[model samples]
Target: MKKIKIIILFTILLLPKLVFASNATIAITGVNTAAVGNNIKMYVTLSSSAAIGSWELTLNYDSSFLKLIGSDADNGGTFMANKVAGASGINKKVYTFTFRTLKAGNTLLSIGSSSLYDFDTMGEMTVRTYNKNLKIMTQQEIEASYSKDNYLKSLSVDEFEINPVFNKDTLEYSVEVPENTKTINIKAVANDNRSTIDGLGEKEVVVGNNKLNIVVRAQNGSERIYILNVNVIDKNPIEIIIDNVTYHLVKYKEYLTIPSGFEETTIKMSDIDIPAFYNKKINYTLVGLKDEAGNIYLYKYEKNKYERFLELKLGNLKLTPLSIGNKVLNYEKETIDFDGKIDVYKIDKRFKLINAKNILNGEEGLYLLDIVDKTAVKYDLKDIYTLRKLNKIYLATTIIFLSTTALSIIIMLSFKRKPKIKDKEQKVKEKTKKELPKDEKVVKENKKNK
Candidate 1:
C-alpha cells in the first residue's frame, strides 16, 4: 500500500512536467466583441516544432449564441478537407471557422480532446490548448456608441474673415477675396469627434460668386451642409450691347432662375469663364444678362450673338416663340380690348411663319390676325384647306338642288290652273261690254242665244 501511494504521487508530479514540456500548441483567435447579426471568423491554428502526421479536434461553442456558418482548412500551401481522415502530414495548419452571432452575450469557443500524431513514429504528441472568449453586443449598445451630432463646431477661411462672424448655428457665409486670388483655404471641424467632415481644404475660386459646401456626416449617418459664398473681385468686367442697350455679364448667379432639364455650365467670353445653363435637347446655351439698371434676364447665346429669350403672355395664352431668327414676325405690342395685351404683326409680307411653339400647352399653327380686331388663332393649314373645300362643295350642291326644285313647282302650277294670258283677255272683253251701254249689252246677249 505504501509503495502504491508513492507510485501514484510520482505519476501526479510527472504529469505536470510533461504538460509544461510540450513543444506543440493549438490556439483559437478571433475578435473579442461583436454585434448581434454580425458574422465573425475564428482561426484555429496548430503550431509544432516538427511536422506531424495528422490532427483531430472537436469544436465547442454555445449553439444559442453562435451558429456555425462555414469553415476552411489550410495546411501550409495545401488544403486539408473537413473529413476526419485524409492523407495529412503538416508542421503548421490553420482552420478558419465562420460563425453568425445570434444573441447578445458572452460566449466561449474551445477545442475538446484534440490529438496530434507524430510524423515519424506515428505516435501521439502532447500540445498546449487554448480557447477564445467573445462578447456579443445588442443593437442598443451599438447605437449608444455612435454619435448623431452633425453640426460643425467651427468654420474658417485662411487669410480672410468670415462674413457676419462665425457661429455654429449659422450655416451660410460670404467672403470676398482679391481679383488675383485663385484659391482659398477652408477649414471645418465637427461638433463630435466621432463625426466626419468633408469639403474642407483648398477650394478653387472664380472671378465672381463661388459656392463651396462643407458637409458633416455623423457616425449615425446623419448629415448637414454649410455653404460658403466666395466672391473673387473682378476689376475689369465684360460688356456687351443688345438692341442699343448696354448689358454686363452677371456676377451673382443666385439671382438667376434655371430652366427645367437644363444643367448649370460655364462659357468662355474673352478668356473669362461665365456661368451659363445648357439644355442638350434644344442644343442651346443661355447666359444671364444684367442690364445697366440692375435688371437681370436670361439671354440665348448663339454664334457670338445674344438675344433676349422672349416670353409673351397674352390673356391666358403664354407664348415662347423661337426668337433666334425669322421664326417670328416683327411686331409692336398693342393693347386690344379683347386680348388685353397683343402683338400686332404682318404675316402677309413674311414667309409661311413656322417654328412658334406654345410654351404653356403644345399646340400648332399660331397666328396673329391683322384684321379689324387683332387676335391670335390656333389653326392647322391642312385642316383649314380641307374644311374650306368641303364648305364650297356643300354651298354649290344646295344652290343647284334648290333651283331644280323651284322650276318643277312652277311647271306643276301651270298644269293645275288656266292660262294667265286667256284669263286676262276674257276679263278685258267683259269690262268693255259693260262700259258700252245697257241696250247694246242686251242685243249682244240675244245674238249669242240665237
Candidate 2:
C-alpha cells in the first residue's frame, strides 16, 4: 500500500511536464541587435516526439516599433522539405517571419497563434511558443569621403560631357573624345574627403589613343589609380602624303576626289555614265574615277573625255579601238572613239560590239555593259537564211490552212439541213388534286387498304 501511494504521487507530479513537452514551440531566432530599417528573421518551429502531418504558424509583432515585411515557410521554399519521408514524421520544420525595424526601439516578437497535427492528422494538444524581444538601433549616417566613395564621379570637358565608364567597384575610368579636339581640359572630383586627386588638368591628345593616369591619394597614404582610357579618334582623314609632297584632299558635296597615285575610300557612286562623252568642262563633282586598270584619276571635268580621263591598260580585256589607221598606235594611252568618217571600229575582246544582242529577246543593239556581267552580250549569231525560209513556210502554211477552213465553212453553210414542218409537237398539262377537289367524285389514297 505504501509503494502504490508513492508511485501514484510521482505519476501525478510528472504528468504536466510530459504533456507540455509535446506542445509546439515558437521563437525569434536572429541577431539580438539590429539597426533601423534592418530586417530580422524569426522562426516558429513546432516539434513533437510524434510525426507531424501539417501545421499553420502565425506571428504578432509590435507595429509601432517593427513592421512585418514577409512570412514564409523555410524562406520561400515549400512547406515540406523532403515531401517523401522515409520515417513517419518530420524532425523539425521551420516557419520564417521577416520584419523591419520602423523606429529605434525595443519590440516584442511573439507567436500570436499556431496549430499542428501529428501523423494521426489530429490537433489534440494546445500549442505553446517562446516570445522574443529585439533591440533595434538607429542607422549610422554615411560620411562624405574622397577616396572611399565612388571614384571619377563627374568627367567633362568645356561644354562637352564625357561619360566616364568603369566596371562596378573598379578604380579605373575610360572615355572617348572627338578627333578635332587637340587639347582637352578635363574636370574630375573624388568623393572621399581626405583623398587628393592628381592629373585632372589639360591633356594633349594624339591622333589615335591618349592614355592619361590620375592618382588618388588618401590621408593614410593609400594610393589608388583612376586610369583615363582617353580615346581621341582621328579626325576625318583629309590629306595623305606620298613621298614629301602632301596632297591636299578636296571634298565635294557627295563624292570625293580620289588621289591619282594613292587609293582612297569614299561614298559609293552610281547614275553617272563612265567613258564620258566630251571634254566639256562641267562643274561636276571633283571626285575621282576608276577604270578597268584600277587607276584612280582626279581631273577637271572640262579636260576629261570618255577615254582621256584615265589611262587604263586592259590586259586580258578585248577592246576594239575606234580607229585603226596607219599610225598603228600600239600600247596606246588615249582611247579612240567610233570612227565618224568610215563608221567602222575593230572589236578586240568584246567591248562596244555595235550589234550585240539583248539576249533577253535576241534583239541586236549597242548597249553599255559591265564586263563582269556578260548575259546581255551576244554569244551566237542568228541564222538569217533559216529564219527567213521558216517565216515564208509558216506564212504559206497559215494561208493554205485558213483558205481550206473558209471553204469548208462555206460548204457546210450551203448544205445545211432544213427543219421539217412538223415541229409543233405539244406537251400535255396534267391536273393536280386542287383541280379535282371541287367535285366529290375523286379517287382517295388507299392507305387503309394497304
Candidate 3:
C-alpha cells in the first residue's frame, strides 16, 4: 500500500509533465461569425516537433444551424491522406473543411477524441483541444418580376386601347397591336433589390402573335414567370416611310391636304387656285415628306405610276378641280373646268408662293407642274418700277434745256451793256485821233475817275 501511494503521486506529476512538455497539438479553428446564406471555412492543425504516421479526428457542430459541405483530407498541401482510414496524417498536417450557414444563430464546434501516431515514438500521442463559435445574420429577402410592374407595350396613340386578359390570380396577359405598325417597343420592370430577371425585355413585333417570357429570381433562389402574348395586326397594304414619317395610300385619292402651319393668316384656301385640267382625265397619287426642320414636301405621281411626276417644295396649293360634266369650279369668283384629262392639285401650307422662305431654300413649288405632260403656264409675277425705261431720255433733255437757257441769259446781258460800252469807245478813239482834245481828254479822265 505504501509503494502504491508513492507510485500514484509520481503518476500525477508525470501526467502534468507530459502534457506540458508535449511537442504535438490540435486545435479547432473557424470563423466566429458567418452571414446567413454564405459559406465558411473550418480548419484543424496537427503540429508536431517530429514527423507523424497518421491522425484521425471527429468534429462536432450544431447541425441545425450549420450544414457541412466537404473536407480536404490532405489539408490541400500540408499533409498526406490516409486512404484506408479516410483521414489525414503527417507531421504538421492540416485539415480544411467548408460549411454553409443555414440560419441565424450561434453554434459551437469542437474536436472530439483524436489520435496521432508518431514515427519517433511509434505510438499514439496526445494533443491539446479547443472549441470555436459561429453566427449567422438575417437579411432582407430578394424579389423579382412583379406582374403589376411589367408591361409588354407602350404607345401614345389614342386609336389603340390596352386591355390585358384578366385571370384568377395569374400574371399572364395579352395586348392587341394597332394595324400598320412597322416597329414596336416593350417595357419590363423588376421591383425588388434582391431579385434577378432574364429572358424578357424589348422585342420586335412581327405581323402575327409575339410571345414574351420574363423570369424573376428572388434572394431565396426562387423563380417566378410573367408571360405576355401580343397580337400584331396587318396594316394597310400600301405604306411608305418618308423622312421617318409614315403615310398610308388610299384608293381614288387625288389630293392630300397639308394643314396650315400658321395659326392666323390672311391666306384662305379658296384664295389659291389650280387649273381645272390639272388632274382632269389622269389619275394622281400623292405622298408627303417631312424633314427634321419641319419642312413638308408633296410628291405627285400619275395614276398607276411608281415614279413621282412632281414634288412641291414649300407652302401648299388649292385646286378646285371640275371633273368630266362636273360644274365649273369657282375660284376667287373665276370659272374653271376640269377636262378629266389630268387631276388638279391644291397645296395647303407648303405653297411656295404663299411662303417666301421656299425661295431661300432653293425650292420651286411648280417644279412638278413643269415636268408633267409639258403643261402650259398661263401667267407669272413680274417686278414693276417707275421711270426705269425713260430715265436716260429725261436726263439728256434736262441737260440740253439748261445749256440753251444759260446762253440766252448771257446774250441778253451783253446787249444791255453794249450801248454804254460803244459810246465810251467812240469818244476815246476820236480824242486819240485829234490833237486838240486836251479838254476832252481831261473830261474823259475825270469821267473815268468818277
Candidate 4:
C-alpha cells in the first residue's frame, strides 16, 4: 500500500513538466540526388504551434563536395550568423540555399544552436532539427537512367494559332501574322522532364517568310527538330525597278541604321511611301531594296534616279564614286595583275578605263583596285602613250634613212657606167681611121714616128 502511494505522487509531480515541452519543428527538404557540376537547391523550413517571431541558426555543409553559390535567407544576404524575423501572423518560414555540386560524393546539411522565439511573449522555444542527405553522381553514373524521349508534349505561340493544330509527331507547322507584328512568342514543353528544349521564347519577324526551328535534346543523347514556317503579310508595299528588274522596299527599317550626318526621312516611290535616309549637304538619300531572291542591298536614290550604292575603302582613303554599272570593264581588265581579281570600271566608253580616282584632287587615272586587300596601284597612261608614239617615229625615221642611201647608190652606179672625156676622144679618132682605109692608116703611122 505504501509503494502505490509513492507511484501516484511521482506521476502527479512529472505531469506539468511533460506538458511544457516544445511542439516546434525544423527540417531541411530538397532533392537528395544531383549530378556533378549541376546546381541544387535546398530549403530550411521552420514551423511551430505558436507564431514564430524570430530565429537564428548556423547551416553546416561539406565544402569539398558542394559549393554554396547563393541563398534567399535574410533577404538575399548570407544566412550565416544572422537572426531573421518571420512575417506578421506567420507561423512558418522557409529559407532557400543554392549549391553547385563539386564531385561525386555524399554530403549532409545540418543546423547548429538554432533558437526559435515566440511571437507574443518573445520567449525562446525548443525545436527539433532534421538533417538532409545529398548524393552527387558522375555524368556516367547518371546516364544509366536517362530517358530517350526527344519529343514535345505541347507547342504553342502567344496570341497566334498554329495551322493544322499541334501534334507530337508533326515536326512542321505554318503560322501567319500581320505585317505590323514585330515579334512572336513560342512555348514548347518537352515530352519527358529529362529532355531539354532550345530555341524557344520571343523571336523577331520580317515582312516575308521567316523560318524558325526548335531543337529537343533527350537525356540519352538523341535530338529532334520542330520547324515553324511563319509568313508575314505585306500591306501597302513599295516597289521599285532596277536594271529592268522589279524589287520591293524593305518594310522593316529597324535593322538598318542611318549613316552619319544623315536624318531619317520618307520618299515616294511608285506613288507609295518608302522609308529613306537623307543628307542635305551631300544631297544623298539611301534606301533598303530587297530583290526577288530575298536578298537585301542598299541603294542610292535621287530625283527619279536609283542606283546600287558602293563604297570602297583603301587604307585611309575612302571613295564613293559615281554609279559603276554591273557591266565589267572588258577592255583590259586582266592587263595588269593586281595579285588577284581586279574590278575595272569605265565611267563612259569614250573615256579611259579606270579602277579608282581621287575625287578631291581630280587625279583621274587607271588603278588596280584590290577590294579584298584594300590596295590601289596607279598606272601612267601618259607615259604609255608617249612611248608608243616614240616607237612609231623611230620606225619611220629608219625607213626614210634606208631609202635615201639606196637612191644615192643607184645614181652613183649610173654615172660610173658613162664614158670619160679621154675615152670619148679616143673612140672618135678610131672611127675616122677605120673610115680612111689603108692609105690614111700609113700616113698616120709615118707622122707619129717623125
Candidate 5:
C-alpha cells in the first residue's frame, strides 16, 4: 500500500510534465512577405506529440517583428468536449498573428517554450524581404511651369505701342511688345538734372512667375528702372497706366476722371493722331489736361469729355474766452457759412475771445454769447452767489476739522500717562493689609490711623 501511494504521488507530480511534453510541438506553418508600409497575417498550429492528460501551454516568441494578435487554444482542450475523458488525448491549438513591416530589411520570428516544463519544441521563421520606395521631384521643372501661366498671358512688344513718358516717383512705365514673352530685358534713358546718374540704365526681369517678386525703384533723379513681370502669354498690347495716366494703349476703353479737389483746364496729346474714321472707331488717343494749380493730368481718350470738383469740407469752429479783464467788449453775433466738411469745435488760444486766466484769477462780471445759424445764445460768465456761499462753508468746515483734530491729539497724549512707582507701592501695601489675619489687620489698621 505504501509503495503504491508513493508511486501514485510521484506519477501525479510528473503527470503534468509528461502531458506538456506530449503536447509541446511547434511548427512554422506559413511564411509571408510585405512592403515597408504594409502588413501581413501568419497562421501557426500546435498539436500534441503523444497521448497526454490535462496540461497548460505557454508560447514565447520574438515580438520585435511579429506579434501574437490572437489565439484559440481552448478549442483543443476539454472545454470543447462533452466529457473530460473525450478531450483527454492529443489536442490541437491554432494561433493567428499580425505583423507590421518596418524598414527595408529582413527579420526573424521565433517561437519556443516559455519554461523547462513546457518541453523542447522550438522553431523560427523569416520574412523573405521588406522594402520601401520613395519618389521625389526637381525644383527647376516646378518653377518653369509656374512662370509660363502667371504673368505672360497679355504681353505685347511692338514699335508703335510704347509710351514716351516715364514716371520717376512711382517707377512705372508702359511698353509695347510684338510677342508676349516670359522674361524681358528693358533699357530706359532719361536725364538726371542735366547730369547722368551711373547705373541708371538697364535691367532684366522674369515676369508672371511666383518665384520672382517684382519691384520698381528709381535709380536717379529723373530716371526710374521698372523691374516688372510679364507672365501673360497673349500677344495683345496690354495698356499699362500708372497714376491714372495712359503710358501705352493697345485699345482705349474710358478716360481717367479728374481728381476730387481739381478741375480740368487743358488737353495735350501725341503729335500723331489716327484719321477721324479710325479715331472714332478705335478709341485710342493720348490726352492731357491741367488743374487750377497747374498740376498736369494725362490719360487715354475714350469718352467725349472730363471735369473736376472739390472733395473735402471744413470742420467745426469754436470760440472761447481766455480772460475777462475789468473792461469787457460787446460785439454783435454773426454766422459764417463753411463750404467744407466740419469735424469738431476747438476752443484753444487760437479761438479765444479773452484770456481765461484773468477771469479765473480776478473778480470780474462777464457775459458769453454764442452765435449759431445767425442766432445769439447768451450766458452769464460768473456765479457770484454760489461762490460766496461755497467760500463761507469751506472756511467753517476747515476750522471745525482743525480744532477736532487738535483735541483728539491732546486726549491721546493724556491717556498715555503711566502711574508712578510710589502709587503702585501704596496700592500693594493696602492690598496686603486687607488680606492679613484679624489681629495683624487690627494692629496694622491702628498704626495706619495713628
Candidate 6:
C-alpha cells in the first residue's frame, strides 16, 4: 500500500507536466497521397498551455520504403528537427512541411521531440500512415490495355463534346471522369497507316467518380486513329457533339461514321475572266450539306462570267497643216462651198487651183459666204472694223480739239498785254522838261538880264 501511494504521487506529478508541455497536431488538407514523383504537403499546428523555451522535431520514417525526393522546410533544411523557440505572447506554433515522393508504397512517419533531461515533457505524436501510389501507367501498358478491350473499334465522337482521344505523336491519352462515378481509369491507343500524317499514341487517366463531361483532345495531331478504354463505376452512355452535330457517345467506345446521304461535290475552276481594273475579286458563295453528326462537306458552283467591257481602243485625232496657201476658196470667197476649189498658191506668184470638191465634199469648216443663195455678202471682221472706225473718229476729234485749244492758248498768251511801269526819275525829268519849255521865253529874258 505504501508503494502504491508512492506511485500515485509520482503519476500525479507527471500529469501536470504532461499537460503543460507543448502538444502538436498535424494534418494534410490539399492532397494526402502523392504519386511516385509528385509532392505531398501538410500543415503542422502545435498547441501548448505553458510557454515553450526551445523545441525540436525529429521526423522518423522508413528511408528504404520511401525516399524524400525534395523538401522545403525552414530554408531548405534537412528533415531533422532544430530549435523552434515558442513565439512570445502566443501559446501555439505552426509550420508547413512540403516534400516530394521518390518511391512508392506506404510510409510510416512520426514527428516527435527529443528526450528532455531537464524538463518533463510529452515526446511526440504518431500521426496516420501516408500511402503513396505510382504516378500513372506507362505508354506501352496503356496501349496494350486499349488493344485488349477493342476500345478503338467502339470509339466515337460527337460535336461540342469534351472527350479524351488518343495522340499518336505524343503517345498519350487524356480523359476526365464523370461526377457520378466514384473512381475512373482510362486507357487509349491509336493505330493507323497514315501515322506519318496523323499521330499515334497511348495514354492513361485516373480520376474520382463524378458526373462531369470530360474533354480530351488528341495532342500531336493523332485524331484519326483514336481508341479508348474506360473503366468507370457508373456505366452510363456519354453524349458528345462534334462541330455542332449531335452523337450518342458510349462510355467505353463507339465507332464514328460519316452519316448517310452525305454527298460532297467540289467544282474546280479551270479559267476565270475578271475585269483588270475591278477593285475586288468576285466572292463565290460555297454551298454544301451536313448530317446530324456535324460533318461539313463543301460543294462549289460552276464558273460564270464575272465582268464585261466593250472591246474598242478610242483615241483623239489632232490635224496639223503641212503647207501654206492651203486656201480653201470658192467663187463666193466668204463661203467655201462643198464643190469649191482649194487653190494651192506657190511662193513664185503662180497658183495651182485644185478642186477641193473631194476634200470639202463631206468635210466641215468655217464659211464666209452663203453657198446656197450664191449671194455675195461681205464678211466683215466686226471687231477690227469697229476698232478702226473708232480710232479714226478718236483721231479726228483729238486733232480738232488740240488745234483749237492750242490756238486759244497762244492768242491768250500773246494778245493779253500789260502796261509797263515808268521809272520815278523819268517822270520827274519829263515834268521838268515840260515846265522848262513853258518858261523858255522867261529863260531868254532872264539870260538877257544875266
Q: Point out where model 3 deviates above 4 Å.
A: 1-22, 74-89, 140-450
The CA lDDT of each predicted structure is: 0.73, 0.50, 0.50, 0.74, 0.36, 0.36
lDDT of 6 by residue, 314-348 (tens): 12211111123334323211111223222232222
lDDT of 3 by residue, 1-450 (tens): 999999999999888544232357887787766678888898977788766666666777787888877777544322333422324335676678788889887788877767767664446666777778766666532122222332222222124443553332356666788654534454444565556666644455444445666676655566767666665654433444544555433211122343222111111113332211123223333343323222233444344332322322323433322222222112112121222223333332221111111212233222223322323222232221245336667888999999999999999999999999999999998887786677787999999999
- Model 4 off-target regions past 4 Å? 1-18, 29-31, 34-129, 142-150, 180-204, 214-225, 235-248, 251-256, 263-273, 278-285, 290-297, 300-450
* Candidate 2: tens digits of C-alpha lDDT, residues 128-192: 66778877776442122213533444555555554544332465555667756567787767756
RMSD to the hidden true structure, all candidates: 18.1, 23.1, 26.6, 20.2, 25.6, 32.2
Against the true structure, what is each candidate's TM-score? 0.43, 0.25, 0.25, 0.45, 0.18, 0.25
- Top candidate on lDDT is 4
1-450 in candidate 1: lDDT tens per residue?
Answer: 999999999998888543232357889998988999999988888888866777777677899999888776443311333322456557777888889999998999888777777765566778888999999999889777778899998999999988978887888999899977878999988889989999999976655657788999999888889998887777877888988987778754565777655689988888877889876655668898866434567888999898666444444544545422423335333323322222333355431233344654545345554334333456466776798799999999999999999999999999767678789999999998887898887999999999
- Between prediction 4 and prediction 5, the one with superior TM-score is 4
lDDT of 5 by residue, 31-96 (tens): 444454445555554455443333333434444444444444344321111112453444454455
Please give the lDDT score for candidate 3. Answer: 0.50
On lDDT, who's better, 4 or 6?
4
Off by over 4 Å in 1: 1-40, 45-58, 73-94, 111-133, 137-141, 151-175, 181-194, 201-203, 236-298, 301-450
TM-score-based ranking: 4, 1, 3, 6, 2, 5
Judging by lDDT, tell me the better candidate of 1 and 5: 1
Q: Return whichever of 2 and 5 wins on lDDT.
A: 2
